[model samples]
Target chain A: MKQEFNITVFSENHIGLLARITIVFTRRKINIESLTVSESAISGVYKFTIVIKTTEDQVKKVVSQIEKIVDVLKAFYHTNQELIYQEIALYKVPTDALYDSDQIENIVRNSGARILEITREFTVIEKTGHKEETQALFEQLNQFKVMQFIRSGRVALTRDPIERLSEFLKERDAFLNSMD
Target chain B: MNKEPMKVTGSEAVILSLLEEGVEIIFGYPGGAIMPIYDALYDYDKKITHILTRHEQGAAHAAEGYAKITGKAGVCFATSGPGATNLITGIADAMIDSIPMVCITGQVASPLLGTDAFQESDVLGISMPVTKWNYQITTPEEIPDAIAQAFFIAQSGRPGPVLLDITKDAQFGELEFSYKKCKKIRSYVPETPVDPFKVKAAAELIDNAKKPMLLFGQGVIISKAEEELKAFIEKTGIPAAWTLLGLSALPTEHPLNVGMLGMHGNYGPNVKTNEADLIIAVGMRFDDRVTGKVSAYARDAKIVHLDIDHAEINKIIKADVAVLGDAKKSLKMLTDNCKKNEHKKWLSEFNKAYDTEFEKVIDKDLHPTKEGLTMGEVISKVSEATNHEAILVTDVGQHQMVAARYFKFKHSRSLVTSGGLGTMGYGLPASMGAQLAAPDRTVVAVIGDGGFQMTIQELGTIAQNKLPVKIVLLNNNFLGMVRQWQQLFFEKRYSFTELINPDFLMITKGFGINGQKVTSRENLDAAVKEMMDHDGPYLLEVVVEKEDNVFPMVPSGASVSHILLEP
Candidate 1:
């Protein structure tokens, strides 16, 4: 089945890399559901989270191509399942919904939504989850009327805790253990 | 006296003993003082494959590349003094990553010791900080035992590079012929089983801590305890954060993973490490890079340090509980005794902060609008195609940071980079070695144009053997990393940073390999795909924008909070 794979890239931050990164998806005719880039902790590093529709093989190709970029240090692709995928959806719900009833508050709490800014006129609710979950929450809020709905692209990580360098270190540990 | 050890020199014994250890290959070059070993190698030409590297450094890195992929001890030989010193960077690289390798170097005659004799150096001292163990063979009789011990130590606990420096006189001296079985070195005992009390205490801490974080290090990966870590995380419901060198300990796509920690780590994990009530540090030393400011790091958390090498304990940050044992064993015990604790409130808050921060960085101007390509775009495209599975070997400088920043390694041993040593001219040879070890897997070497020329001589080695390696040259016509430093710290002087190079395409073609030049993003995907599809070696020159700087950089000796953001 054709599925959406979100590629989260952490690389040296620079200009026009986004257009270049998007070019690959566009050229391959893979639909980019969403894409975003941000500054990382390291001054030179930038993190990119992009959602695209394609098969595993296609995603693999896209990832390899992404890795070849001269400025890029690492490119990682995450499927919906393989990653702790999350996207932020900002919704401006009607102000009446916040004060008039407890229904919106209950729904927001259950969905783990945070009220970023509130006023007598409007309420800004932020929800972060799997893209689907975020979308579903946004859809549910449609009944109450949404002033604005925006979502950041999905960023993900594997469930496994062992890191690449740590694995190498652990190998030595195992070798030493066996020696003992 | 036993017919002078059957009429062989110390170097000969070194080679003979390696054969006994089943070393089918040795990467080295003939040099002064080490000629005796080369002579012995000639006799065993048919029995072993000897690859002649352009430099001693190349030999060491190749050995590391080989060992990393095959899980076997990689052997490299170098002559004494300069030869030995040249291999220091690679040696340190292996030490930091804990790759199993044995480096044999020829030393000056014992009489010439401390005399600064021609081509003579105190190799044992020079390599002390970078190696797990080192030995200087003073007598021919001890050659066999020393080499055996070297191999054993290199392949043993937390496998790391071991150095054996044999004096020239020792190599020439006559000794009795006998292969003696090795007994354990009395002084070199590594920690084994976890103390049950400490293990139980650690488990209890994990079971009760409201907010917990696990810091996985290179030690866990070297221990091959990925499954153990996964199981433990699942059982105890702990979130994980790793160091830059610890990229492969857990799959980058794992749910509980908070991404690479420390100064450049993801927001949630880096901050969470400070906020957690209990921090489980496994198989990792508290390097300055990871700890930032020790006083402020994990201030509220109780640290549990687990390691196989006891010496590492209390070397950096003090642990609340130090469990001296293999990480796998300790983690296993902890998992058996621990109960899952929910940190929903903590995790939720962290997730929100992480998302907000991540979005802000990516939403800004990150792409190059000018005619030339930016390093990030090129790397992102390459990563998009490779899916983070290829073995990435990198040369030092801006390209190294660029590659580390962009590449996502999902499996252990997937990325072979010079971390501690940060050696230039490392990418090509390292990639060749990694490819040789994992012939079926893709191996990519990302190097800056300046760094590329430093070891470009290896192009002959790669072409002659037709190794399937993809060399990506990030050409900006300058020593990008140093130049960046000059710009940031030295007032943008740009001293001796410029580089002039032969056409990479033409040069690669001269070596009878495929080559291409990519100027725009439009040409990047196709050009890289072509190289990936090529049957033999391929070189791609990516013309990146000059004067590009990596942001969020923590200036030297500056606090982690003092990050240099791009304007």
Candidate 2:
């Protein structure tokens, strides 16, 4: 029952918060597949996107623990079906392979990849796709003497219309108002 | 409410902020990195009293003790590197036990950070996992805000330790100082709203349950809901059992109070947990020690969990009705919704189990027929001598379990021990803090020989301050708890559990403290009396049976119902 789970957390921009969030997973012995942090759409707020393969029970617990951080505003976990996600990958290939034949060009076109730059030593190709698609392109280009390959961590957005963080903040503010 | 700000050094600003928060005493040690703050402290001796503990670890535990008794955040100070690292144990201890503590550690100058400078350490990174919240202040302007947030986070909601690592440059920097207490943080909400629907559902379950049982923890004391808990129990006439940290929430003599609940808890509470139809857990997590095997623990029972932290709700055992909020408000709401009734038949069942346990374990432990003094007998005598009103601070070991079981509590916050962390060497310094918090109340520290050695230097602090803290050293000549496990599960290898020799009386005498050593039962009463009757600090070392073990133990991974009275 273990499958890919992407956890998204929204928090105030604070120092040492990333360490606090990672320690939750570390303490539980859950390995992080990929992690990415950046400023969200909201001002003074940051978003953390983490990918891991764990059971539903474990993912729920981990998400709850993440939300328990002092600066974290909200946390949510989603499966593949609920998220629209992609990873950007770059492949470096020997320029000689391109000069030898048009096969590499055909492969890149078929894989929906674009050549970013070409030099005497190397040709750089960039692709934005799912992990499997990126890996498939890498395998196909491996025969062309691909010198290097790198992929960014998964960046995702929920399929739902409304931002979950906005809704959470509204409810939180309402609660604070009710307390008064 | 506007006031003119005063210009001062950053170190002075730190003291002014603490004074604004009404901090009277600080447990700390001075070091090169923190010398600036100590220098500023030199002039404010009358406004704030600083007790210089021998080690940073002792200061941490002393702060924990102070916090637990006063229901406020405890404050401790340490320098960078080794001084800050020494406080890691105390910080982790406070984290697990939910004791509110604000730990301030000095760091190298801002420019020296990450440069491998002398006495520099990444205290923020080192303390990240253990602290509830932490921040590093490199500028004097951040001092007031950081300290304000530290206290707010430490004492609010599910209380835990918080650390502030201030660089040396910040301490030396000058700025305009104004103190403002933090009332709220937009990202962090300390109180969870009590859901009426959940409260109704829980009350309905309690009303319909034929045999309902209540399990309370330190949350009861934290929320100051002892009276509410008592009223709830009285309304339902349900049997109540307490966790180790919840020992003093209810008077031991309460009619409905059953006993303790955990690995070495009273037999009735552990055995009856599985039998109860509905388990209303108030402010207590179902720790592994309390629930031996989660799969087999209370399989047929419906659990109603009340807590302030939402993460603890279904982390272990799922709750059929989870009322998430302060226990005081939740208990009151549930009590209002429930009907008045009595479960005498169920109550008698607990009495029956208690009778069996008392006959098999309690009788023999409390009233030994043969040989050396039992830990249980000594604890019982100390309880009697203090009239059960003294605050009992204990270190981790078999002695902690014995003291928790035998000591009778008549008031709240009477028991202070490292329940979640089980930190050794906690009692000696913790007793100092407890004594300082409540000057009129007698503070007795029950420590094992092994644990006593862990923080014995605290004796110098007690001597210098002339703090009246009674120290009861239960010397079994071994690390009894681990040895008990070794004897039962590890085939009695007794590896490194046995200690060599030390003249405890001589050690106390060197520290300028009165002491006595009792070897025979004939002199036990008089020795306890003399120690309790003494005006200043005193240590009473009683040699206990070497091979004795705590009974009614549920072996690891075993069902609570399968608890063993004898190996």
Candidate 3:
């Protein structure tokens, strides 16, 4: 019953909000495989895209609980099929290893990666793909003594373009205006 | 910009907001950081009654008792550092038990927040893990909104404790105060309206089931849905059981109201849970105490969990039909669609275990057998003395379980005890709150000697206020519950459970309250009567059997059916 889930959370940026949000997941003993927070299209609202391996039931409850936090505007869980997602990974290898090597270029081309820079000490290659693909490219280049490697957490866009949180805010503003 | 509102100091805002919220009483202790609010309180003396408890913990428990009994948010006040830390236990207790409390803790000036200022601590940070929600107010402007939000969060959904930590500067600062009650939040929605289809489906399931049972919890009283629940039980003729907090929800005398269901619960309900075809749980979470060993607990029963919190729906036992909404509305909906059917066979099965339990445990316990001043006998005596109408606030331990088992209630909200938290020192101060909340009723605090000493300082609060709360310290000279566990499981290695005593009567006398000690069972009835009768706060310590254990107990982590009928 355990499958990959992408939990998307929209919230107002507040001090200690991230700590509070992480505490929720920590208390539930749910591991966050990858988590990324960034400014959303709506001004002042931030979006957190978290990848968690859990059951659908667990994901639903977690989303509902996350939504309970005062700063969280809305939270939702989605399967990979419902989200267009990708992670960008950067690989740094010794420049000497790539010296006059057509093999390094062939590996980069096959993995859909491109060299961003070639310094005196290292060459940096950036790859944009699913997690498995990035890991695969890293394994293929391991023989060249990669100096450093880093991968960004998943950044996702939902299948539907219509934003639910905006609608909610519109309704809330109407209510507040009516009260005035 | 909007028109500026009339100006008031932060302390004034707090006072006005409390008045607006209809808070009649508060339990608290004064200190330097909270002086401004206390001073403001003095000016508005006519609007509120604040009982200065001996300790912050007592104040917290007292607030809990008030909230539980009155179905409103109980308020408490504390100063910075040690004062707020002392309230930690009570706050955690309130949180776990779903008791609504708005705890206001005063902090040092905002500028000195992170600095180690005099009597300064990060109370908001310390209380976050334990509280349902918390807010820190830096100015008077935040007082109205913060307090409103605190109350709303504390009382809504699965009600729990919420703390407001206000800096000292805020209490002294002035701001334009226009108080607006928080009816809704941008994100925090407490009530998720029930689905009619889900309710109908649950009703249909109930209508079709042969052996239907209802397990009610504190949510009934919390939601004020006792009548709706009663109608549901009467309509379907299903035998209903109670979680500890659910004890007084259905009158003990009701035919369908079977008995308690937990580790120290009755035998009938525990055993019958496994055999029931349909288990309709309302308002109560499937706590581990209620469902002994999760794997073996009601495995055959098709569960229909109706609760306000959606997260609790399938957290434990998977609900075959989940009806998520307020219990009042959900019960009404379920009741409207169900067909009336008499489950005589199912009812008789419960009777069989009752017969077994009565002969094996209840009969011997309630009626004494030379075990001097048996706990059950003392409770029976108290029940008789008060005509079964008193508000019983019991502390946790053997005494609490014994009092809960024997004390008969005529109405709901009559028994207030720490169920989920199981806090040991809750009785005395809670009794004060109970008496204050229901001024006419006799509030008896049945506590163990160990638990009694924990908050015995509250006797000062009682004496000062002249609140007529009867204190029954069941002096076993041991942490009796843990001792029972030690005896039963740890090869009778009663390590460190025994207590060196002080005379409770003398202690009570020191607090300027009447006191009595009864060792002989002969004086038990008279002593209980005297305490209940002449009590403008009286302490009666009854020395009971030290080695006796509460029976019909399902050993921890075992199935309900594995309950021990006798030692």
Residue runs of model 1 more than 4 Å from their true location after superposition: A1-180, B1-11, B108-118, B128-130, B172-176, B180-183, B362-371, B485-502, B554-567
lDDT of 3 at B464: 95
iRMS values for every prediction: 19.8, 0.8, 2.4
Task: Please give, for every candidate in the order listed, the TM-score of chain B alone compared with the true chain B.
Answer: 0.90, 0.99, 0.98
lDDT by residue (A11-126, candidate 2, tens digit) is: 99998899999999999999999999999988888999999999999999999889889999999999989999999999999999999999999998998999999999999999
Model 3: which residue pairs collide? Answer: none
Off by over 4 Å in 3: A1-3, A54-57, A79-82, A91-110, A114-125, A136-148, A160-180, B1-4
Global fold similarity of model 3 (TM-score): 0.94
Residue-level error in angstroms, candidate 1, position B7: 7.3
Give the lowest summed-lDDT range of ten residues in model 1 chain B: B357-366
The window of 10 residues in a row where model 3 chain B has the poorest summed lDDT is: B1-10
Top of the candidates by lDDT: 2
Q: What DockQ does each candidate score versus the true complex, computed on alpha carbons?
A: 0.01, 0.81, 0.45
On the 0 to 100 scale, the lDDT of residue B258 in model 1 is: 68
Residue pair clashes in candidate 2: none
True contacts kept of each: 0.00, 0.72, 0.41
